[model samples]
Target: MAEKGLVLLYTGNGKGKTTAALGLALRTAGHGQKIFMIQFMKGNPKYGEIQASKFIPNFTVVQKGRDTFVRKGNPEPVDLELAKEGLNLAKDILQKGEHDLVILDEINVAVDFGLLKEEDVEDLIKFKKPNTTLVLTGRYASEKLISIADMVSEVEEIKHHYKKGIPAQAGIEF
Candidate 1:
């Protein structure tokens, strides 16, 4: 059994939001605890973390979007369906309490982009087991989510390599 779990949120218009969550997942896996990540609005199997999870014990990564970018305020029907499917999977993961750490990757963006409803995510958080640590990542985290979270980290982008004409490198940003 795990210690008292926390509801953590990492948000803002900066990089490392998902990186921070992955760091925590790594720590959890280091302790031989289970970790599950459901990535919303991202379906690229080539991502470094998705590739690395294959070698990590008791760690699972599920992607729920296509390789194409989702247009804000006009997401496709398949995007909506995939997001809903991911949310339902998250709910089941929380209820079952099978994983010590659960990461809802890019869920805030999904909600902000109208792919998923805020209330539904809120209720999912409420339904989470006491022993399961929940981590929500992505920008534009709602006030309600912040209020409910035990800890919230906003990663403000002071500077970025992307603005410096540097493209995303493999294993660094994926």
Candidate 2:
């Protein structure tokens, strides 16, 4: 079989981007493929990513960006720094060619929020390993990214509990 990686971009206004990627990661890990995840725009320790890391071997999950919810107008320097670190780690993993799949979780939000530059993302895409599948998740994906992706999935929000003033529940949301 030809060992080549493909780019996967998941974007939309609704939810499930990260969840989709996580599902993919779990599937890949079950097949004995190494996986790595870099989470951007997320700092909460009580996330599902943390729990997955505990049992999954050959998996690394890094959380960067602010712990608080993102605001449109205000972005702190710490958030930017954390995002940069996450991007750098993703790049390093991609270049190393160690993992079979690398998930840039919430990268679209990072790029949209201006924490991660589009140019750097483009460079990562350009230099990615031949057999390293890359999955980017978040809303507001860039046109350039979409064009390069082998598979693009958009999770549209038809209905959400948050709209009805329901808080994010554990296991389901996290």
Candidate 3:
């Protein structure tokens, strides 16, 4: 098997960015490779990562964001602190090199929102292990990140339930 490390950037203004990262984690885990996922800008527990954590031993999912979602026009100080903590944890994990694959879920959103600095991310990318695959997922990927990434995927939003007056559904949208 090939043992080359790669930077994967999943961006765009659409859904399934995190889902795609998680799918890669599951696939890697199936191959007996340990996977670690750090979630930024996410606090709710009613999601796929929580469900996967129950049965996947090799999968470690950590949510460092606030317990409540950050909404527009009313950002809380705690949200920023939580995002910082999460980013720090992710950096530590990336440096540890214990896992075969590390997924920085929704990290781009955190960076775009100014919760984490771009320089810090660039540093992390620089120090990643030679054989450790790193996957970053979120909308609005920065140009610097795209330049360093080995592969980039953009999810386009063409249509959605929100536009049709339908609320987000459990196990489908969540």
Candidate 4:
């Protein structure tokens, strides 16, 4: 068991938010710690992280949502259901102490899009185990979440190839 766990938040309007969390996942799994990732608002099987997690012993990645993008204020019913399901699973995993690290990938964006309530996310944190570090990633993190997190990192995008009309390539952006 861990001595203690931290609530880490990775947010901002830039790329690499999920990448950073997956990097942490790799580190945790490398240390022989069990890790679970609930990728909300992302359901692509071809993502490098998803494929890589398959090879990691203690790393489990579950993707929720469709390949299409969720509209800001017009999320579908299925989107809401998937996000809620992911949040519920995360809460259960955290409470059960089955994983040393739990990463809620793109959960901040789910909250921002109204697929989840900030209070629900708060409840998950409240039920977190002492030894389970919870990492929340994605853009538009709430102020309340930042206030409560033990560590917060915002990845700002100065420039990107996407802005240059370059498509998101596999292994790079998936």
Highest lDDT, which number?
1
Q: Which of the two candidates, 2 or 3, achieves a greater lDDT against the reference?
A: 2
Tens-place lDDT per residue, model 4, 1-174, is 538899999999889988899889888988999999999999889888888888999898898888889998999999999998898898789889989999999999999999999999999999999889999999999999999999999999999999899998998887
Better of 1 and 2 by TM-score: 1
lDDT of all the models against the reference?
A: 0.95, 0.88, 0.85, 0.92
Q: All candidates' TM-scores?
A: 0.97, 0.95, 0.93, 0.97
Superposed on all Cα atoms, the candidates' RMSDs to the truth, in angstroms, are 1.2, 1.1, 1.7, 1.3
- Per-residue C-alpha lDDT of model 3 across residues 2-79, encoded as one tens digit per residue: 789899999999888888988898889899999998888777787767776779869988887766667644557887
State which candidate, 2 or 3, has the greater TM-score: 2
Residue by residue across 53-165, what tens digits does model 1's lDDT show?
99999999999999999999999999999999999999999999989999999999999999999999999988788888999999999999999999999999999999999
**Collision pairs in model 4:** none
Q: Which structure is stronger by lDDT: 1 or 3?
A: 1
Highest TM-score among the candidates is held by which one?
1
RMSD of 3: 1.7
Q: List the residue pairs that clash in candidate 1.
A: none
**Full-model lDDT, candidate 2:** 0.88
Native-referenced Cα lDDT, model 4:
0.92
True lDDT of residue 104, candidate 2: 94
